[model samples]
Target: MLRAENVTLSYGAEPVLEGASLSIEAGQFVSLVGPSGSGKSSLLRAIMGLQEISDGRIETPLQSTDIGILFQDDALLPWRTAIENVSLGLRLNGRDRGRAVAEAEAWLERLGLTGLGRRYPRELSGGQRKRVALAQVLALKPRLLLMDEPFASLDAIVRARVTQDVVNLVESEGIGVLLVTHDLEEAIALSDVVYLLSNGPHAHISQRYSVPIPRPRNLVKSRSHPTFAPLYERLWSDLSDVVDGPRRIRTAA
Candidate 1:
């Protein structure tokens, strides 16, 4: 359960978000999609307390407020092995070192990262690293997971697998997730509710598409579904309006 009410974010004189609102009930997976500079990342950081919202309110259950965040970058410690990296969050949360290591290892196994834990970040491939990163967050058992392009770095096949793993985690844990991504297909494939923001210094929700696909949705099958084509076409059209928006000009005398 997370909600941003009449949210606004500005950088000095420039505004990036205006009256953008989103609500996620427990166990819902929501995607925020928009063109570059649409303020998707800003909205997420604000909700996570990493950025200050210029105005409005963000509310979530206190206990669940310690949300987990996964970024496009794995953000793993280069020197640390996978298991060590995974346990970092738990360690910071006052978990005992031994117990944290054990828990992290268990999560790694669940995500299909068993023996890989001994490898350092540099030794792991991109997909392996992302899974290690995901394992790190999932190990926390966060109530809300904020992801900003979690699959951006992986290849298509890897991305699909990672997406499925993430979906599985969300369902099993029943945690709310707000993911910011530019990929319309990825958003639709993985989310229950998709929010599209128009591009601007202060972007607003241009449209919110609710996916009627049944629970336990499949990314591949959903792509070829009849409704998928129309919905995706519209989402792309909305996003392109901003991505290819007219350039501001300087008037000359």
Candidate 2:
């Protein structure tokens, strides 16, 4: 439902992205992975209209309200209780207070945060807070999700469980996702397709790998899939090449 075609982004005169392109359809899970400073996050910002692109274009039939973002910070309000936080968007969007609360409560329950609604963010564990944040986003019934390392801060175990929860929720809801992450294993485990970005100053998509694993995916079990290791190695090798390519050129110069 969304396409970014030959997009380019620049900060002042320094270009960060050039000819970077990708697309997403309903129920598809897509990821962008690359070295630090490669503009994976910038591409996402451009898609969201939070950052202006210098060239090319992003097209989507969905309105701004149709998109939801989850950042690594979760960005939950420190003062709002869980249910209040989840319902905030609905309330602002003109949903009736009672109806918004009811819908928010339902989303909290769906995300396994049923009894925790009354608690503040400080009262919840990391995983629980992440779920609350997710509930906050998904409660809006967004058509597309944009995640920027949303699970990166959680511990490995919590990260895995929350990742699986995300996979389950988004798949069940048929929402398309564009995730920007530095973790290749996480990318492989979660995405239908992973696009690798070349290193900046003028970064672009370097490779696209279609994940061979089937869906209703278990994050842990996906690692053991027959095709998983080989894909991981190939991605790792390609990532290394892109990271090293600049250094090699510098050395030659």
Candidate 3:
């Protein structure tokens, strides 16, 4: 549903991305994994039209208003209740207040947040807030999802649970996703395609790997698949070569 061809971006004289290309099909999940300075988030910003690309083209059937993004931080309004937060997008779209609330409640329930709708961000746990943020995005019915390490801030257990929930929900809705993450296991487990970037000052997609694993993946059990270890090792080797090298440690964007 979205394609970037030979996209380029830079800050002043230093280029962050150069000739980086990738695509996401309808209902397909793709991920970008790379060192901190490799422009993963910058690529996302470019795709979202938040940053201007210096070269090439980005083609998407969906408009900027149709894309939904979830950031590393949930970015929920502290004063809004969970349901209110979820309903914000619908409200902005001119949905009826009652209908928006009802739909938001249903989505909250779907995300395993049955009774937490009335709670404010301060009252909810970290995971619950993330779910609210997710509901907010899904409420808009985005054709493409742009996630910038949405699970990175959560604890391991919470991250795993939320990740699984995300997979189930997005698959059922047939929404395409382009995720930016440093976690190779998360990328491999959740995405159909993984694109690795070389280290910056000017990073490009150095390799692309297909995850042959089937959908509705068992978060725990899938790790034992014959292909899992080898894929992990291969990705780790490639990633480590960039991050652990003599280059300065730059966290994955």
Q: Whose lDDT is greatest here?
A: 2
Query: How well does each candidate superpose onto the true structure, as a TM-score?
Result: 0.92, 0.96, 0.94
* lDDT of candidate 3 over 1-253, digit per residue (tens): 9989999999987788999989999999999999899999999988988999888899988987789999999999998899999998898899999999999999999899999999999999999899999999988989899999998989999989998888888888899999999988888888899999988878999889999888877778778878888999999998888767654445542
- Cα deviation of 111 in candidate 1 (Å)? 1.2
Error of 1 at 40 (Å): 0.5
CA lDDT, every model vs. true structure = 0.87, 0.92, 0.90
Question: In model 3, which regions exceed 4 Å deviation?
Answer: 244-253
Candidate 1 weakest ten by summed lDDT: 244-253
What root-mean-square deviation over C-alphas does model 1 reach? Answer: 3.0
lDDT of 2 by residue, 1-253 (tens): 9998989899989889998788998999999999999899888877878999999989999999999999889889989999999999999889999999999999999888879999999999999999999999998889999999998889999988888989998989999999999999999999999999998989889999999899889888999999999999999999999999878889999
In model 1, the runs with Cα more than 4 Å from the true position are: 242-253
Clashes of 2: 0
Whole-structure CA lDDT of model 2: 0.92
Residue 102, candidate 3: alpha-carbon lDDT? 95
Model 2 misplaced stretches (Cα beyond 4 Å) = 250-253
Cα misplacement distance, residue 170 of candidate 2 (Å) = 1.0
